[model samples]
Target: MSNKNPSTTRIVELAKQKSFNTEKKVLDTIKSMIKNKKVINYNTVAKESTVSKSFLYKNTSIRKKIDMIRNEQADLKNVTNHKGNTSDKSKDVIIESLKFKIERLEKEKQELKDALAAKYNDFYNNL
Candidate 1:
């Protein structure tokens, strides 16, 4: 009477049943397949588990975990780059400060020489 294909609908129902098991069996199977290099792609995982790709996409916790891992990797790269820049800047600042101090010390040395020469005429006369 209705538009239902009973056999086709029954297969679909069985596949859907495999998609939502409360036991750890489904996740464990997925992990084992990954470990054995059997399920290679998301499509394969979906097919093997009889789950839809849309189901994986809709799981907010799994999506958030993936995002967090990516964010942490990016943060690590940024910190490494920042450290390199800071190290270079610190070296430049140290070199500039040393150069300034050297110039100041040379100026003081010249001034002291001039003052001594002026204060002692006999020193110059004896020489």
Candidate 2:
């Protein structure tokens, strides 16, 4: 029969509690990071949360959540890119056209000012 000391049993229980606490803390940190829109990949989570990558992979719920978030981000990027291409081109064209119109109007305003100044000089000379 194996000998089991009371002190040794208590020590083992304490160690298990510590391990569970550490895992819970790390999981909470990971959730907070996700809520804050920080990176959610294995390496980033492991680095930011001080949790091992192996531990994250071994935990099925955490691994699934990370994968789902990553996939959603990827899908959002693709959709944005597809929609933005056409809109961006049109926006660029409109902006350039507006800039050209403003430049032309400014030039016309300067010409009118110069003409008015010349006419005033002529009127003063004739007076």
Candidate 3:
């Protein structure tokens, strides 16, 4: 016979079953939301399922499924080219951002060089 009391074992089993049922319920809620094209975020899932938001975030598998769906949905909104690549607008945006960054960096570099030249002139005069 096991060391644990029968009642305690029964209680533990019931708790485990409850947890499993709740997980299933949450998953079903997510599926229904997907079928209905509803948002699949933590708050929406929890609200639709009547479960706790913490519970939705706390469960690893459920969290991953939600994240995967949400990310896939977000990607659907992007403008893609024929080969499922970035659109011209997206490329243009990326190019503009890089150009801005390069210009800013070049300005900073010039400022540094000017400061260094002034410092060198002072050092030479002092020597």
Top TM-score model: 3
Query: Number of backbone collisions per candidate, in order?
Result: 0, 0, 0
Tens digit of per-residue lDDT, candidate 1, span 39-118: 23446655666666676556554345434544665676677664444687798998899999999999999999999888
Off by over 4 Å in 3: 1-7, 80-127
Which of the predicted structures, 1 or 3, would earn the higher TM-score when compared with the native?
3
> Against the hidden reference, what TM-scores do the models get?
0.30, 0.50, 0.56
What candidate 1 gets wrong by more than 4 Å, as runs, is 1-56, 82-90, 93-127
Q: What lDDT tens digits, residue by residue, belong to model 3 across residues 1-127?
A: 7757446778899999988999999999988998998868898998899999898888899999999998988787564423558899998888999999999999999999999999999999999
Best-matching candidate per lDDT = 3
TM-score of 3: 0.56
Q: How does model 1 fare in lDDT? A: 0.63
TM-score rank order? 3, 2, 1
Clashing pairs in 1: none
TM-score of candidate 1 relative to the true fold: 0.30
